[model samples]
Target: NKIVLPVASSGIAALLLPGGRTAHSRFNIPIDLKATSTCHITPGTMLAELIEKAALIIWDEAPMTHMHAFEALDKSLRDILSLHDPKAKTLPFGGKTVLLGGDFRQILPVIPQGTRAEIVSASISHSYLWESCHKFTLQKNMRLSEDEKEFSNYVLRVGDGNPLPTEVNEFDEDEEDQLISIDRTLVEELSSDPHKQILEATYGRTDQWKGTK
Candidate 1:
């Protein structure tokens, strides 16, 4: 049977797929990475054998992973696949097919206390391997129902930093930063004990949940 490896940048995303794993865990990627880092996989090991046999890899939440991780995997794959095919040494990920899924407008690679430039630089889009990747976009939100279409579109606009017309008057015409206005219906006013109010709103009143669990 053809092996299809499904991995994600986060544990929660990994669980959504069949037999999925976190990319870092599966590849043994270094926590402290450099520009020229390779995965911890040793040649001729079971993991290496599995990589050699894998027909495709599906990586979800890929935009959230540091570029060095992908580079490290690429280096390791080339090293392992070169044992059987010398030409594989020059190919990206040893010529294995890789499908990455994520939205750039959503959460990107987190660089602790990093500036916008540093974070952008750490994204896979900035990696050398990105040149070889083919891009695709899903134009429709199939998961949302017709009633939720407007809300989904609004969310997308917010994620893209596009301010609604109602908020345009609040900012200067020459303003570089985007200012989005949240719909009043979506906002909930909290009391003095904000945390307790939030908890009650989410799980119901304390009396309602007391001894239930």
Candidate 2:
């Protein structure tokens, strides 16, 4: 079996990797890449022993991290692996396979008080290594039930800035400043015994919740 290092931009990586999750900043091969005024990576004083040990690296929720971080890591990795093999310096990720998985529709790079341009610039797509990235598509909504498949597709469309159906009544343009309109009946139902409703909804049955008790 190949020794693989599993790292994440967030905790979501824990659910996907058996080795658990390591924070992106801490995912180092016995060396640190210090951030500087320039985007170029400056390698720290150290032996990259982990580079020789690990066969692959799996990074989850990658889009949530800044592009500069990835670029720095890429440069650092190449520097480290070059010490082991000269040709590795030219390889993507230092000739070590790296799997980076993240849904663009999910969480984005957090740019506090930053403009739209800053937000876009922070994404991994804007990184120097993005051009070499091989794209993969995950079509299935594994979290949703068969009955909620349509709802899952609709939610994805909405996330992509597409308009919701008229019946959904998400917003009222006629009202002051396009106020969100919550259906009265739905509100009443939700407000009453909200916890119990949530439990039932979560497990998909009242009996399922009762059994856990």
Candidate 3:
């Protein structure tokens, strides 16, 4: 039977999708991948068989995974599918349709103690597969309520590295070290009884939530 596989770079994102799993867990990807690495999936194994039958794969948080991870999957898929068709070895993802979803502005792959250049190099956009991939942009913020549009736009502007009108006077565009001040209205001040205020905000008033279990 044909199946759709849903995977994500992070556990939280995987849990948000139906029948989803972490890409590393599902693909048996190595923790330390190299340029010539392939996934540890053995041919004729249950996972390999499932991959052979997969109709499509949906990977969320794609930008958060290392380029090496994607390349590893590509090499493994090509090898696995080549068993059926010799030409599959040259095709991407073994010719199985893959839908990758993520905002590059949100987060890139993490490399411990890696410089900015290393982090950018580790992103999937730097991989060879990126050349063949089609790109789509989502222009609207569908999840935000009507009242949140301004805040959402502000957040987006920050992510896009655009200086806000309020910040133009205080920050120099050319300065390597720049800081944007948060609006006081958005901050919750806990000047008095900080612990109690935190508890009340998190779990509601003691009387309302006490001994409910």
Candidate 4:
């Protein structure tokens, strides 16, 4: 699932769902009222339902979640599976399969008062912020054209395995503005007439002067 708020989202978060699909409406995920996430993760009733129903739970673009956010989600999944009755107890999302998707180079979640979570976050050897293996990658990108795709592929293979070019700037960085501010002379010329002297000019020399050149 795209854990980001813009497209599909946790209903409790009331993220920017286009048509107003409630938390329970899209998938049976719910927030544990007791839990708060500094980052996005699978947990609580929401995570519980996913583990119970889905054979694979893929968390895409969620690496930016914070440590406590990860913790909350971890505890939640554990609680869900450990409980015999969902209402009565929580259980582990243990023995469950999960996949994470992200560029680790994109936007992140921001909780009320929390630090940004790190992906590849854990320093623990063989750590589990409740993550699973059996990983896969999408190698092809339809968005890029022949030149772009070919260049990107070569960069990925030769560079540090991540192909983004060095010149790629952060979203907040200044960009080359496309807008041009023409002087008043040009504006007046454009607004006035179809065959004004300069407008009718064929080149540096006008039609009247064309034969001279």
Q: Against the true structure, whose lDDT is highest?
A: 1
TM-score for every candidate vs. truth? 0.88, 0.72, 0.87, 0.39
Give candidates' CA RMSD values in order. 2.6, 5.3, 2.7, 13.8
How do the residues 1-213 of candidate 1 rate in per-residue lDDT, one tens digit apiece? 899999999999999999999999999999999988899999889999998899999999999999999999999999999999999999999999999999998899899999999999999999999999988988898889999888888889888777465544656866636456786757899699998888887888877766777
Point out the worst 10-residue segment of candidate 1 by lDDT.
Answer: 162-171
- For all candidates in order, the CA lDDT equals 0.90, 0.68, 0.89, 0.43
User: Model 1 misses residue 46 by how many Å?
Assistant: 0.6
Error of 2 at 115 (Å): 1.8
Candidate 1 regions exceeding 4 Å error are: 165-178, 191-197, 200-211
Query: Could you give candidate 2's per-residue lDDT for residues 78-167 as a string of tens digits?
Result: 777788689978987788888898888887888889987988877989876888899999888899999887677666775675634344
Task: Give a tens-digit lDDT track for model 3, residues 1-213.
Answer: 669999999999999999999999999999998999999999999999999999999999999999999999999999999999899998998888899999988889889999989999999999999987999999889899999888887788777877354455545767533565565656788658888888777788877866778
Choose 3 or 4, whichever is better by TM-score.
3
| Whole-model lDDT, model 4 | 0.43
The worst-scoring run of ten residues by lDDT in candidate 3 lies at 162-171
Runs off by more than 4 Å, candidate 3: 165-177, 198-207, 211-213
Q: lDDT of candidate 2?
A: 0.68
Better of 1 and 4 by lDDT: 1
Give the worst 10-residue stretch by lDDT in candidate 4.
118-127
